[model samples]
Target chain A: MKFLEPGLIALDVEAADGAAAIRAAGQLLVDAGAAESRYIDAMVASFEEKGPYFVLAPQIALPHAKPEDGVKEASVSLVRLREPVVFGHAKNDPVALVFALGASSSEEHITMLRKLTTLLNNPAHVQQLKDAPTPEAIGQLLEATTN
Target chain B: MKIICVCGLGQGTSLILRMNVENVLKDLGVSADVDHMDVSSASGTQADYIITNNELAQSLQGHAAKIVIVNNYFDLEEIKSSLQEVL
Candidate 1:
């Protein structure tokens, strides 16, 4: 299955930092029926404890919590930041995109993580995501990655 | 067999990295088990090696396990080389 389908986008988030973006993205994943509501808090707590590796590359963030924290399903939540947020890492560049993930088990989670990482590795796609203006546009961008 | 423990704030990302490491080990025909531990509990574990990103590995200094800090967990080539060196 395509990890990120059209319904996963929650565009135009107004989070001031990585922590808030994680919470918002987690909530969206829950609302999209991809994860349990409790997973949102767990994801936020992980960020609080670990700082943000989610801020992998410039302007990109991929925040996630553990499966044991309470994941009902496997899915991803995408949020485009209105303004960049500093996550306090050495790569403390402001984060413009947030992709919060939820998985039911370790093996399944890792598979999705691999795909997401491969996607993020593409500079061209990252640039497109940064420039996409609407949720629909973001969805199209993700869909294009599937090919 | 070398055992590598990969921990994150929780075990989520650690587990993902562990799986990737496991795949790398398999391809190399190396005998190893890459396990996941929560960052809180990772300090107490006994392991032959520890593979993690800069942030978490920084806090695990002077542990019994030899730590290898990776720039990104998804970088399979880097992880494979580090594991080979430790083994």
Candidate 2:
């Protein structure tokens, strides 16, 4: 089962800032038909209002908005940036990995979070994602997490 | 004790943190009603502890519940230690 569409996976992306990085990630969801374009704006606004709390770990970010924001379907997307962007997070700054989630309900969100946390808790798996040579390699890493 | 995990979106990162917090609390034999909430709505809710990162912790500084700032949400040890300090 492929939760992350092949088109949604990108490697070595260039982003100017954290919001730009999030936008790039969110765009993947848009292309996959999982989220509306306005969802990107909601994600950006949420980040601006609540600060960089989405920076889950060092070099990683999980950017998302409320289910009511603009979710068309439940999905997750990943973006690996060529250059890390400063998100103003104290410990987790200069994030190079962005994970954007679009869920239609809180249940879906929680379920996805459960799987994501399992993957994130392992430092080695996260390192693999950071050092993934290609988008396909990144997809394989994420697929392992889903299972 | 009711603990609320506050984040930008109620269901994303905060929910993940909530799960880790639940696990750590279980290991320590600490029982509490842990909830996940969004930053804006979290202000009005009641909780014994409001667990969040430094960014959102600022918004919840004066809340009645004790605010625990977690620098690394994925670091279970760090989370366990932080909870040990206040719990």
Candidate 3:
């Protein structure tokens, strides 16, 4: 469904809390023409209620909100933190990659999640993603997943 | 027929797990219907079992379905074995 567009990359962010992470990701989504400006609040609220859901996976976070929460399009915003921010999960590791996802519906979004989960489960791929410094590099890494 | 409801906090991951489960079942020649439910709205449903991760499965404490903890929803091998046990 072409959610992660060419412009959905925010190189380095300096977010201290979950709310700040949502703001940074929301801005990227808005800039990418994926979501409206109002989606920032919805994303924040969703995170507040359910948290980042990082689970046992350290250094990675999947930030998403419901479809009815002002999603203009299905898209993903890739954020690399300059430093790590703790989201109070059991893993207690700083988040390096925050993938802000916005989907049109639950079913449609699952396809993307399946692909993303496969990528995340690979330690080598996750390490490459963390080491990638430029947006273009991150795009290349994502492209490799399809191969 | 055995039913397995796959759910996450939102419906996205749950739906993905449901699709994968269905595909795995089809390949195994198993007869079952997999359903997708949001973790928040999964109460009061009747299913043979619930297949989800540890966190989401904990939320379905009062459900009628037997909870089967799936470490990774995309792990076809794990999901297939778990479903076979339940069936």
Candidate 4:
């Protein structure tokens, strides 16, 4: 199933820092009715609590929080920053893409993550996502890559 | 064999790690049950190894399972090399 939608993507957004970047992505989930507003705070706080472990790859940050932390639905959102920001991760920093994910349970999370991991493993695809000019472009890219 | 992928929240990052660890183990022809959980829950869980990042590995220092610190959750080569040494 196609879970990620064009409306879920926010391209070339401006953020002062990593927290704001996360907020930009997380806010999209909230706006999509996938999560409560506080879910965004939980995602931001998770970075502070655990450092940049969520910065899974160079130029990529998958900011997320627990299902119990206000996730109303299982969903993912994308936000590409106009300017990359450092997440303080030793290796992966200056993150350019923020994917804010919210899951109501592990089973639901596993389904979404399988697609996410596959799409992210290819650097070309990552670059495509980064260079995608519009939300529809990003959505089309993800749809084309799904297993 | 059993492995638990852990993180502070035990939801996003750890789940990603768990999937990679499962993949690495499969590549090595090793049969193992992989799980993911929060740090607090990890302390009470039974596992042969607890795969976690460098920072979360600190609080998990005294857990029964051996701690394997992975710096990058997305790097399959890094995950495989680290798991090979201990597994």
- Report, for every candidate in turn, its global Cα lDDT versus the true structure: 0.71, 0.85, 0.70, 0.85
- Name the top TM-score candidate: 2
Candidate 1 Cα errors over 4 Å, as ranges: A133-147, B1-5, B19-32, B75-87
DockQ, all candidates in order: 0.29, 0.81, 0.25, 0.56
- Clashes in model 2: which pairs? none
Q: Scored by Cα lDDT, where does model 1 land? A: 0.71
Worst 10 residues of 1 chain A by lDDT: A1-10
Interface CA RMSD of each prediction in angstroms: 3.1, 1.1, 3.9, 1.7
Clash pairs of candidate 1? none
- Model 1 over residues A1-147: C-alpha lDDT tens digits? 226665777667798767788888887787777777888888888788767765645676678876677777767778888888888767436777888878556566656776676566567777877777776786677667744
Candidate 1 lDDT, tens digit per residue, B1-87? Answer: 556555565445675667667878888998775677765577888888887777677788878888876655555777788877867
Clashing pairs in 4: none
| lDDT comparison, 1 vs 2, better candidate | 2
| Candidate 3 per-residue C-alpha lDDT over B1-87 given as tens digits, one digit per residue, 9 for 90 to 100 | 656555445445565567777877898898776677767666756777777766556677888778886655445777788877866
Q: Which residue runs does candidate 2 get wrong by more than 4 Å?
A: none
What is the per-residue lDDT of model 3 for residues A1-147, given as tens digits with 9 covering 90 to 100?
545555787767888876787689788888877778777887787667765453325676666667777887777777788888887655435777787877677455656776777676567887887788787887787788843
The fraction of correct interface contacts reproduced by each prediction comes to 0.20, 0.87, 0.09, 0.43
Error at B3, model 2, angstroms: 1.0
